[model samples]
Target chain A: MIDWALVARTLPEYWVGLRVSLLLLFVSCATAFLVSIPLAMARVSRHAWLSWPVWAFTYVVRGTPLLVQLFMVYFGLAQFEVVRESAAWPMLRSAWFCAWLTFAINSTAYTTEIFAGALKNTPNGELEAARSLGLSATQVYRRILWPGALRRALPQYGNEVVMMMHATAIASTVTLVELTRVARDVYYNYLAPVEAFGVVATFYFALTYAMVGAFKLVEKRYLRHLAPRETGPAAGRPT
Target chain B: MLKKLALAAVALAAFMVQADAQQTRLRVGVEGNYPPFSQISPSGQISGFDIDIANAVCAELKMECQLVQQEFDGMIPALAARRFDIIVASLTITPARLERVDFSAPYYDVPSQFVARNGAFQSHSPDALRGKRIIVLRNSPRAAWLQQNYPQNELHLANRETDVYLELVAGRGDIAFGSSVVSTEQFLKRPEGAGYGRVGEPVRLQGGTGGVGIAVRKGDTETLAKVNQALAAIRSNGVYRQIMARYFDYDISPSN
Candidate 1:
């Protein structure tokens, strides 16, 4: 059974946690989106000099667990005396900064791969048509290649967003006071896992639902051409 | 299908009966990361002051001691969930924990202290630490004390007790507040803690009974009594002192 009364009393704490989780989610998502574009571009580059390095970067980051990466950034860097004495120590010392950096990098790796796959899957005919229009390489990328790939990448990108949101829970281990951390603190105080984790699960479920629904709308608008032909009277009606 | 289910239930009952018959086995939960108190050595052996004490108590009870390594934060919940029978994890006796689990009579009462880079801080007063980062284990009584007493100071709550010192040594935090036993034995004695030293006097929070005790599930008075009896036997028979001598130069036995 759920403890509704405890849930009512802990609304303020959950609110604080929700704000932290949202901030972490939004900031890292934006960072990932921006950074991934360029990295994804390089990942799909024709030149091995550019694509191989990006490929290696994503390979190393994606191969390892995000939690381990987070710990390395948050705790591992501090183990070195040089890091402690450096100017960057001020930023590295912050839990928020470490968490954000880890999440952003992790998301960047996955998002880059998603976008790269989408870019690779771009129709050869589309590229030919863009070149035939006398568009330069940059113009082709901006006008045709990037837009089509991004539209194709929408559904998978939506999945990455949801996964990143869930991954933010690990930020609590570094003491970011996100939703999971708040739930853990509540559990520590009340010893009621049902009341603590159950409420957090609801919050996460609601957030995920909203994200999924929003992604659906975006996909519908951008991916309309890929959808099956409408079977309306004006469409395939016999003369 | 119904007949098979009934037969399976009968088999489970027999298994439970056999498990209950094993009275000699004692499953003890321990956080094998808290040095001096408990830690797993490089050889993967779990040994410490707490491990020795638990072993001595098990010896007295003539029970087979099985140490189950667990995280400090999850000790109580694990105990409640029957993951382990008792916690020998240097768990402080506090009212909040008392609400969930019953504790044995205080086995040791080590004072808390603040550790900072030597000569970096003069006093542990709020004014001196104002705006300075003070690291402590999250959800700890010491964190609660700092929140109440030193509101102006920034509190960085690390997940593990060792992290409190790690963050300090990493220059992330200006001061570390935690068990004196751990701060002294685990950190200051190690090479990594070369520049750090205790800066403040022994701090015992007013929130708890100010003693560390073994925790067992609440309402399990039978196990509680046995643990208490074993503790008394160890103390009277000099086992407790022998173990204490191995770890500390001073007496750590519960006062009063």
Candidate 2:
């Protein structure tokens, strides 16, 4: 049986936690988007020197669990004497900074791989057309490759965003009061697991759908060219 | 093959029932990270004051004690869900917790204290530490106290008792607030805790008695009575004292 009264009392705390989770999600995703563009380009490079390092970066980050990566950054780095006394200790001491840094870097690894895959799938004809049109290498990437590959990567990138949102729950381990921590605190205080965790589950469910719906609209707009054309009588009809 | 597998399943079920009938198994929940009270040794054995007391109580009650290690924050919920019958993890008896779980007679009482780097500040007053981060274990009596009293100070709630001091040593917090015994024995006496010492007087809030008790699910009077009886038997038979001496030079038996 769910306790409605307990849920009402804790709803405000969950809202505050939601705001924190949202901030962490958006900031990390935005940063990963910017950083991954270059890393992903490097990943698909012809030069082994550039490609291998990017490959190694993605391999190392994507290979390990995100929780372990977070712990190493948040707790492990603090173990070193030089790190504690360093000029950057001010920022490193902050749980917010450490969590955001870890999430963004983790997101970058996965996003880089996704974008790189999309880049590899670029139609050879499109590249040849851009080259024959006398477009420079920079112009080719900016005008043709990036736009088309980003459209291809949109669906997978949306998944990464949602995953990143869920991953923010681990922020509670570093002392950030995100949604999971709020639920846990409620559960701790009331011993009402149903009301505590159930409410958080509902919040996550709603957020996930909202994100999925938004991505659907974006996909509809950007990937319209790829959508199947109207068939039979509808193909010849004028609106 | 199907007939042989069915026979093996029946035999396994019968053996499990027989094993269950052999002894009254009691699952005891503990936070293995709280040093001096409960901690896992380098060899992975759970040993400390709380563990010894739990084992002695089991011996007194003639029950088989099985330790279930869990994080301190989840202890009460796990108890309510029957993940364990009782908790012996140095859980302080406070009014907030009493509403959800019933606690046995006090086994030990210790004061809370603040530990900061030597020469950080002498006072633990809110005015002195305003805007400074103070680290305490999440869901703890100290955290509750700081939230209510030190409204101006920033509170950093660590997931484990050990992490309270770890955060302080890592310069993540300006002060560490926790069990005086743990701060003294587990932190100040250790090499990493060098240059850090108690900076204020002891605090006993909530019920103000600071009794640490073995907890059972609310309305579980049967287990509560058994735990209380076992505690009394161990105290009278010197088992409690023997365990106490191993962890502390000072007396910790609750003063009634």
Candidate 3:
């Protein structure tokens, strides 16, 4: 049922689309990672004043559909004359920039919640022990809280990154020409959904597996102390 | 379990046959977003030039017409899948589309034109638009034409024709190119579009046939012929002109 010949002939176009999808995935992932760190910290703050706005940001972003949010950024913002005449119009007008901003803000909300939850779950004994060792509040956070919480958040964050990769498909609606958009164009031109979407499915599957594999390696490195103690020498062998 | 599966398959085949036997109703597909061609009213009725033309064609063919709203991109696929008998979606007759479905004779034609802020350009020439951002509907003939002829211009593709105009108005694109009917009726007539005007003359691209027609499944010659006859009847009996006058003052029929 697979059209291997067509897949071969159209590989280059798919490759270009793959590059776009990956660019969106990596850039948005990096932006989310950086933004979520501070947002998560603020979310777990002792003061409500520090945390409420972040709460509201995550609440609204997580509550709405990503497509709606994308549209709001892409089309809704342009409805304002002030936005059209703003200094940022040059960047805001580019579909790629709008898509990146939407995805970054979206993933940051979800990732911030994940990191905050993990931070809250950090062992209280560790914080007490750090404090007892004469470590300042900033030193405790820098040396103990952030690292431990991050390690705990790794698996969930990995899943979030993969979800973000899939979510990038929606960027096509804004005409960014990512993987899903390329598949759609191919389907439109060739009238062969089987071959077109099949290729897309394969690419996504491989990328997801690669992401999962990388996360497994990172988890092994960072969460090793959390693993069950091995009794035999051979038990140390990599799975 | 095996017997039940076989029974289910047989039942599906019977239903398919029943569906095929019911030919009294002409199921028409329309994209309700394309203004002046087809649009959904606030009350949810599909009405526009394409819808009216489809209604006239159905009257001539003596079939009850049912309008099904579909996205423009999915209209042909929906027809091939038998979701509808014909598409009256202002779909341009193009060689790429002909490979998948058959189209009746042209019912109307509207040249593609570029719209930009007033005084953005004196002419729509490659030199004038060089290095300027241009927006067009994705997968459209205008997009293909821009990519081929004005490769120097920065091209942006928008999924919706409305978004192309939005990009232009927002200063993302220097010009927006799309159907003249849509540009004039949907955008140019709107208050927000007051600052914009059609730039240069309507662009007639080579191999970009602007003819809009009723689309049917490939090899469906009987329905194709009936649609063509109905189209010709409407045009000759002045029904076409009457309908055209309601929506547009100028002639939109194919130039040839």
Candidate 4:
């Protein structure tokens, strides 16, 4: 029922698709980390004006599907005369830039959720310890709190990272020629559904496995320190 | 328990029988985003000349047609995937595409045209386009044409026909290349289209008049002949002309 020959023939094209996909994953994940740090801080801020808007933004973006958000950005926003005239139109006009921006924003929303929770669970004792040593508010956050929360966030952040790797497939809908799009082209050309889609599934499997593998290296590298302490309630007891 | 299993089998058999009897259910593909030739209404139903022609052809064959929307770039691939049985999309029959699939005799023709911002000068080859930003669909025949001939022109491939026009209007590119069908329907019809204009005379160059045709997977002789018969019926019965007038301001060369 599946066309393995078609899969074999389209391997090179799918490889090209894989590169774009991997690039999108790397760029979006990296940018999401940058964007999420600020958004998570604002979201978990003490002031309602700061936290409330960030919370609402996360809620609405999370509520809507990525497809609809991409459509709104790629198609809906282009309908306005001013957006078409803006200096950013050259970059925004490109499907690659649009796909990159959408994925970055979407992943940032999810990563913010992970980082926000980690920020809350930051060791208050560490902050008091830094304060007892005459560390300023900034110094406590920079030296003591940020590193602890970041290490705590690693495992959950790993999950969000894998989610973004799969989400890159949706980039094809806007015309980015990524993995799934290439397979669909092969599928249509050969009229072999089994072969075309099987190839796509295989690529996706390898890609996601590689991503999780890479994350494993990152996890073991930085997390080697956190591992000996992570056992039970004692880890979260904050002192 | 055996009787219950037997009953379930019979029901499944009956369902399959009904589905086979519904062969008259036609599935036609079109780029509903491309107007006049094919376009989708706000309610999400496909309409315009190509849609009407597909319905009439299906009626002549005594089949109930279902319209499916596909992007211009994906139309051929989608049709080949058997997502639908026939492509009523304004697809041009090209030598490269023909290698992979079968096509019915062309139903209509649209000339390929190059368009640029109002102030730009016209040159036929890439030497003039050299260092100039030119827009075309990636991997389409026209893009290939430019790559081979005017390789010097910087190519900016866009996904949709409107994207070409939008970017050109924004001065993002020096020129945009596409079918006359898209240029006439979207750009020339709009008031603000004054900023953009077609270059050179609309000559039959490069890919020729670009004949539009229906396509299916190769070797489906039964499907191919049946579609031909229905298309022949539409042309003879004047239904094709009726559908044509409903959409186009002028008649395209169907005799080709």
Best by lDDT: 2
lDDT of candidate 4? Answer: 0.78
Candidate 4's residue-wise lDDT over A109-192, tens digit each?
888988899889977787778889999877877887778778888888988888888888888777688988887666544545
- Which number leads on DockQ? 1
Please provide TM-scores, in order, for all candidate models, with all chains considered together.
0.87, 0.86, 0.88, 0.75
Q: Model 1 chain B — which ten-residue stretch has the worst lDDT? A: B201-210
lDDT score, candidate 1: 0.89
Which pairs of residues collide in model 2?
none
Ranking by DockQ: 1, 3, 2, 4
Query: Candidate 4: misplaced stretches above 4 Å?
Result: A1-5, A38-43, A47-102, A133-135, A173-175, A184-194, A216-239, B1-33, B39-47, B51-87, B95-101, B123-127, B191-194, B203-210, B220-243
What would the per-residue lDDT of candidate 3 be over residues B149-252, giving only the tens digit for each residue? 99888787787777778777766777899888788987999997998999999876777765877899999998999999999998899999999999998778
**lDDT: which is higher, 1 or 3?**
1
Off by over 4 Å in 2: A234-239, B1-33, B39-46, B58-85, B123-131, B206-209, B233-238
After TM-score superposition, what is the CA distance of residue B118 in candidate 2 from its true location, in Å?
A: 2.7
Interface RMSD of each: 2.0, 2.2, 1.9, 4.6
Please identify which of the two predictions, 2 or 3, would achieve the higher DockQ against the true structure: 3
Where does the lowest 10-residue lDDT sum fall in candidate 2 chain A? A230-239
Q: Regarding lDDT, does 1 or 2 come out ahead?
A: 2
Report the lDDT tens digits of candidate 2 across residue range A78-164: 999999999988999999999999999999999999999999999999999999999999999999999999999999999999999
